[model samples]
Target: MSDSPHQMTPPPPEDEVSGWLRDRRGHFDQLVSSVEDYAIFMMSREGIILDWNRGAERLKGYTAPEIVGRHFSVFYSDEDRQSKFPDKELEIASAEGRFTVEGWRYRKDGTQFWASVTITAIRSESSAVEGFLKITRDLTEHRATDEMLRRSEERFRLLLESVQDYAIFMLDPEGHVMSWNNGARRIKLYEENEIVGRHFSIFYPPEAISIGMPGSLLAKALKDGRVEDEGWRVRKDGTRFWGNVVLTALHDSKGELRGFAKITRDLSDRQQVEHLRETGRRKDAFLATLAHELRNPLAPMLPGVDLLLHAPHDVATVTGIASMLKRQVDQMAHLIDDLLDMSRITAGKIALRHTVLPVREVVDTAVEASNPLIREFGHRLTLNLQDELMIEADPYRISQIISNLLSNAAKYTPPEGEIALTVSEKPGPMLEIRVTDNGIGIPKALQHSVFELFDQGASGSSGGLGIGLTLVRTLVEMHGGSIALFSAGEGQGCEFTVRLPVITTSAPAATGETPVIPSAPRSGPARILIADDGRNAADILGLFFQMEGMETAVAYDGEEAVKIAANFEPDFAFLDLGMPKLDGYEAARRIRRMYPRVILAALSGWGAEDDRRRSAEAGFDVHLLKPAKPDDLREVLRQHG
Candidate 1:
């Protein structure tokens, strides 16, 4: 293999190079003239048209022979020509090497359209300005599209600004406020100047801001395209209001992060209205419960009074009727007392009478009170008492709390179920009482609300006012104790634990139980007035009073009672609280004015503390719930006579 030297060719001569350049210019001209999108042409340094291509003919609507030597200024509108814009374009291109702009251009037919033009000044070998190469593109359609887009954006901006209920605004990709609208000002209580450029977290609560919630929301929106949330938001004045917000991420055609669009609505007023409606529903439920509880005691009293009146000679029957009446009266009083106690508890008007007592004593009293129910349900009671375990608490309320819990367990549990009450002293000077039952357990969803008033569980088939647990919790808390309930869902049974702080003190002296007093003997025939809206209630009660050695006069309404009392000159008057024409309060005031010494009493279904206070204010000596017992009446008469 012989290594031979590479040979190099010599450069072309000047004459051959000039010929090649000329051929290339011809080819470039042909290519430019073939294009139809842009008008390619040439203008002399004097602003005269030198050459025109097919594109120029198509764009300017002129043939080569008709427009070749014409002034290039003819392509401009008359006003542009008058302003010498065409001449100025040449001067700028000559001085700066090129001039490019978009402006109006004229066609051969006297019509005008938008165009983009570029003029490049050609220079000779001597650096002298030669002809100019001008290229123009008809941009009329593009201009029309741009105008439509501009109008659309204007309309969108106006729509957002006009909204009053929604805070429509914009934020940067970094969660900074960008633009504010009228609705934003109205809802957020900040002016555009004050809010723009600030972090969007300003609208969030302090707690939410501290947790970087606003930034998290922005990131979520960017990932998910949109995010919606409802929560508390702060206004410019620092007042809190509920807000419903939607955040939508904005992006460009290239998928570049632009910003976000945030729309917020103030829902505080709507939330308040919904709350009030819920309260109204609870009130309606309570009223229905009140009606049901009242009728329970009244149902049995009706026939007991009838038997006593129609069979007075049957001592055995009379005694049975008297006992039944007494039991029913006590039941009614208990129902009324529960209602009043709940009211006082809710109003924070109840006071606890604290005393040192052994927990065994409280447990014994509660077990005694609940023994009947336990036996009725056939439940086996188990007691785990720590001997001498003591606490300083309200003895009566504590006993009531324990009794209610035991009673609840008995009622909810099936027959032959087991109930255990355990009392123990825990550390920290705390006394714990746990009541457990193998009963129908509360549902998981309702366990949290079991202590709420009027909340009834699925096991509430046994009749109750639904306030037992409410009272239990209220009384336990009043004694500086806490109560908690646990259940393993439905049918898994339940356990309630109560913990109270214990104190070191000597146990109080135990008082003797008061003896039940016997009913007094009816002295002599005494006049009485009875007023009630319910005819059955008034007639039955009047018959019993008449049988008890009292002259009874009946009236169905307050007005009738007042008229009857004036004529009868009754020594005692009973007025119903709710009656037509006149109410019990007014009737009592009028009757007391007429007969200053009459022992006035109120008879009504309502037995709230306020009812009693109103009765006293209206001159009633005593307030009695409806279906009053004959023995209670005889006792009152015995005292007055």
Candidate 2:
């Protein structure tokens, strides 16, 4: 291929080049004129204004025809112009390529404004200085904002130092004290200079410092962003005070851990001591009364045993003694049950088992349980119930509530007294149950405390354990309901109204009663095992089952029960939860591994929901409280069958 000479393109004529340059300059001028925020113009090397745009005209309060050709010194302050500072700015920009400054400048009207100005030398290709391009921007609003923020910071510092209650301070990332307010000095009895370099652990007790509590707390706050604690804090005087402290982690804008901000409040001992004393007084009174009540039950039991020993052959005399003892035992059991319920309520350990139940069924159960006591007192009982009312409640607790009120009335009322129970619907999604008794009414002064724990208001000999009303109110509230007392006077009658939220007015499913299981022992697992730490309890239960024609074996502890299960492999096992030698839960787990299908029951005196949950976790099918009624035990067996 033949090589071709490189094609050469001729440059445009000077006239055409001048036209293109003019076009670009016109575009630049248009662009600079539209800018409103900045004053832009061209100035001579001598600091005289050579060109002006719309922005410069707007900023300087002069049109292009009026301000052009004027020296840029007009924008400077009088003192600056007198000092030749305007000329100095151009000279510096020409030598250094650019110069920038922020100061006060004047408009054509002679008003002053804060401004930021930059002057840049327009240089040729050989770097020779030409005219300068100046840009001026208004900064008045920004300066005002910065000044206001500075004043605000000063006020906040004063306020923090003036606070007298809370001890506010700052710490470095290493937990060394950095800043202290006046409140910190007052509360800790230490001057700022004395504590600024000290570790925050100085405020904690010696024991806390020995265990690295302060360092650990700082780490926790750093991790969790904030932490609150209350404990004894030491003062410089060596006295200790209970302080509630809050430590908040401070962070920078980049989310980096900066330090900590701490606030402490002194909860002085006087108020706490008074509260504790009142609590102790109530507890002491309850213990004394409990001792007396238990003694009353045991006192008659000893005499009854003597009577039984003397009248060994007389059936009538023995029956009377047995019945008397049974009543006393029942009374003691009732007292204990109430105490347990109250404990559960106060500890927030009780979880209600709610069911959609008809109010009539609950009322009927309560009335039946209370009839014997009512008949013994020769009291007239009346009931007024609305039909087809349903509620969501723990059925047992609901009945217990009514039974307690009824028993209280029977115990306090004179013979042949009248008691009334009325259940009616209300306007809202609520229903009301009222129990009234023509008994010694509550005194006016004591009405407010009638439902408090261990309250002795208007409670004479017939108060029972003095916690029935408290239990009633707690149970009612748990059902999302409320209870109130109404009394005319001491001589008149008293009424307790319990209002409960209703689930529905009528529903077929709710109206249907719970399935009835026979209380008599029925066909179930033939081979059974019973284990307990109490030999008498275990043997008696075994004997009772054997009498009912079931093969039964008894063990005194958990280890023996597991050994028996290894060979005997009973179809049903009732294990006392508090057994020695490995305990019931472990025994149940081992037995379950051997016979996964075997039914396990936890028999114990402690019947909290947590206990039941633990039993369930250990593979027990049921948890029965101590002194399990014959009827309850039979129902358990029937389910298995």
Candidate 3:
């Protein structure tokens, strides 16, 4: 009934105060001891350290007794302390209820340490002034690792940008160019913005696109993870080049393809080099075959003709042997000369010696040179020359060109066909020379490649190396002129016309009369030596010389000719070029070295200006082409003797 007289009375104030203090102390202990790495401490409302925990003692190198009651400003460096950062931090924390930052802080020993610090304004039940609870963790190693990783990424980006040889770029899933670098811009001629959203098929040529190569390449890359190809590619300007292209499909960790990476290289120069090398190889093989086959037939003709001319054979037999040897040897020699000339031209060694000459003289020489072949073919020829027509050109070479055209006309035309050489001077500053023939005209399709070396027309039946016209064009071009072929169609006959610019003529002297000569006359010949690789050519020339009553001997090469000079002791010597053991040039040198008095004359199939110059420098007094006329040979011998 008394209700426990002790319980009825209110609890004592002292007991209540003790219990509250105990509760607050328990909360502080739980908070400080539960910490793992952060240092936890208590400060007064004035920022003085009221308490320090084990974590604070271990991390800040401060014992409780040393840190207690000390101003929290001791955690700051001297500069920060002077700037009142610690006080400012406390004020901010109190105003905002909390403050957090990462900065450098000083330890008890004054060594600076990187720290992430959080300052909180501890509140009481009435929300009045209370101390601050600070939690801090060292952040030096983590910050260093992060900085190092950032630098490494920068280096990787720089490496990608510096590459220049390959056009490395990225594409979207649908094969759109997503990214381009400097190499891409240089190789594809597409700027970054211009190519960013364009389809990759723009790089393919029209022919490639017609065959669906672009789309097929993308599909192959998607299926196979990668695809590579080499072929012609197009640029922004519509120009084409050989390109090596590679496409690689890029994927993510989930095994789904993200996009593609494309790399391309310009291979135009490489393709050109490969093509030239292959062409050179083919040319070499063709020349070798031509040499072997052409040289075979001339072997028997040489000794046979030699024995017939020297033995006690009847005049008819000797004459017949001489004619066969001369015709066959002349044909074979022409083929060899063409091959050699083509070789020289391709090597860029053909040089021309230009001069001003009367066009009539050139035409006359061409006509006379082709007379034998014309008569053999039983073709009628007509010549029409303008009296004063003149041109600036290499006279001998121009003659050779005209003669080649005439002979070609004669060979291709039927018996009793008509061939005409007409010369006329244009009003301006050019002379026009035309050679027309009634023969099997060139087909229209062959005209495109008619001037190409070794493109023999319609193989087998028409026998020629297809070099004469090419040579004609080259020579005409060198003379600052042009040559063209005109034909109605095959079997409708063809005509070739050359137009050469003329040099202004000098004023004529006051001479009253012009000189003329009779056509029927023979120049006397003296002693001469004949040298040729084609024994048929050598024997034929020897027979011709014997008929002209000039002492002569046959030597197959330059070395033999040099030895023969000691016994024959001739006043003049004729030598052929391109012989075995030693060439005519070296033979000429050796002959001049042994017998400097002998007049060395070169009788060769090679007749280019450079060839003639080389002969002259090697001590040849004169250089003449193969299939030499008896009169020309006699004239050469007489001039030297």
Q: Residue by residue across 436-478, what tens digits does model 2's lDDT show?
A: 9998898898897778777655865464667888899898888
lDDT of 1 at 630: 64
Q: What TM-score does candidate 1 get on C-alpha atoms?
A: 0.55
Error of 3 at 22 (Å): 69
Model 2 stretches with alpha carbons more than 4 Å out: 1-279, 305-325, 461-463, 506-525
* Positional deviation of residue 161's Cα in model 1 after best superposition, in angstroms: 3.4
Considering summed lDDT, which 10 consecutive residues are worst modelled in model 3?
A: 1-10
TM-score of each: 0.55, 0.55, 0.48
Instruction: Find the 10 residues in a row with the least total lDDT in model 1.
Output: 1-10
What does candidate 3's lDDT look like per residue over 1-641, in tens digits?
Answer: 12221111111233322333334645676556545477887666777665566667767887666666678888888899889999899899999999999999888898878889999987777775466788888887887787789889778656656678878888898999887877778888888888899999999888789999988998999999999999998888888888998899999999988999998988999999997875676457556656655766577687876778577458787777768876777778667776677777777787776666677778889888789889988899998887776566677778878888898788778888999998887766777878999988888877656566655443322455557778878877877888888878788788989887754484333445333222123364456788888998889788878987887788998788878977776667788878889888888888777666777778776677677888888888778876676667777655544
Clashes of each: 0, 0, 0
Q: After superposition, how far is residue 136 of candidate 3 from its true place, in Å?
A: 52
Model 1 score (lDDT): 0.82
Clashing pairs for predicted structure model 2, backbone only: none
- Model 3 scores what on Cα lDDT? 0.76
Q: Report residue 401 deviation for candidate 3 (angstroms).
A: 2.3
